[model samples]
Target: MARVVVEVMLKPEILDPQGQAIGRKLPQMGFEGVAAVRQGKRFEIELAGPADEAAVERVRELAGTLLANPVIEDFEVHVAE
Candidate 1:
């Protein structure tokens, strides 16, 4: 079986309001010294076949088509045996 990991994040130029809000509240909540914080999405997928080129292609397609918005977000894919 193969394992695929995907990560999706907003573009750097885009503002991450959720992350900024959390970061601001952390210090107020006494979680002091939190320099910076950012949020993103992580996904883990299991493939029926071995970790091969086809599996890699499938993961790439999934990420590009459904997992991420190409206009505002970027994604990375990783495959493991």
Candidate 2:
């Protein structure tokens, strides 16, 4: 089986409250020098066959339609090494 990765992230304009809360808490936890933080979702997909162009395209389509919200989020699909 081949592994594919689908990363979904909020758009730049969209507010990420979870990320912001983590960022604010990081400094208190002694993790410093952090400018900003944004959160996203990652999906590891196991494919039945090789991770070829066709497979990648299918994952991309899935990401666009189901994995990520096109109105407020963006997504990228890639084959895992």
Candidate 3:
């Protein structure tokens, strides 16, 4: 079996409310010197074959079409190894 790691995140131009909330609250909790914050998603997918280029491409397609919003979010897929 093979594994792929997928990372999904909002585009830089997009506003992340959840991440903004965290940033705003951190200082109240005694966390200081904050620069910025962003929230993202990560997925570990396992396939029943080798982690070849085709397999990685397939995962990238899936990420673009299903795992991430192409309009406002970007995704990356890579072999675990």
Candidate 4:
């Protein structure tokens, strides 16, 4: 079996309320030196076969269409080590 990772993040132009809330609270919680915070989603997929180029392409397509909003978000897919 192989593992594939899909990471989805909002576009730089988009507003991230959840990430902003976390950034604001971090300082209050004693976390310092934080420049910024952006929230995103990660999906780990288990494949029945090897993590080859074909698998990566398939997962990338899935990420673009189903796992992320192409209008507001971008995604990357990779094979896990």
**What's the TM-score of every candidate structure?**
0.88, 0.95, 0.94, 0.96
- Residue pairs with clashing backbones, model 4: none
28-69: candidate 2 lDDT, tens digit per residue: 999999999999999999999999999999999989999899
Q: Candidate 2: worst 10 consecutive residues by lDDT?
A: 72-81
Which ten contiguous residues of candidate 4 have the minimum total lDDT? Answer: 55-64
Tell me the spans in candidate 2 whose CA falls farther than 4 Å from its real position.
Answer: none
Q: Write the per-residue lDDT of candidate 3 for residues 1-81, one digit (tens) a residue.
A: 999999999999999999999999999999999988999999999999999899889999999988999999988888888
Give lDDT for model 3: 0.94
For model 1 the local lDDT of residue 79 reads 77
Task: State the weakest 10-residue window (summed lDDT) of model 3.
Answer: 72-81
- Model 4 whole-model lDDT (C-alpha atoms): 0.95
What is the C-alpha lDDT profile of model 1 across 38-68, one tens digit per residue? 7899999988888688888889898999999
Q: In angstroms, how far off is 11's CA in candidate 1?
A: 0.8
Listing every candidate in turn, what is its Cα RMSD in Å to the true structure after a full C-alpha superposition? 1.4, 0.7, 0.8, 0.7
**Error in Å for residue 10 of model 2:** 0.5
Ranking according to TM-score, highest score first = 4, 2, 3, 1
Worst 10 residues of 1 by lDDT: 49-58
| Clash counts for the predictions, in order | 0, 0, 0, 0
TM-score winner, 2 or 3: 2
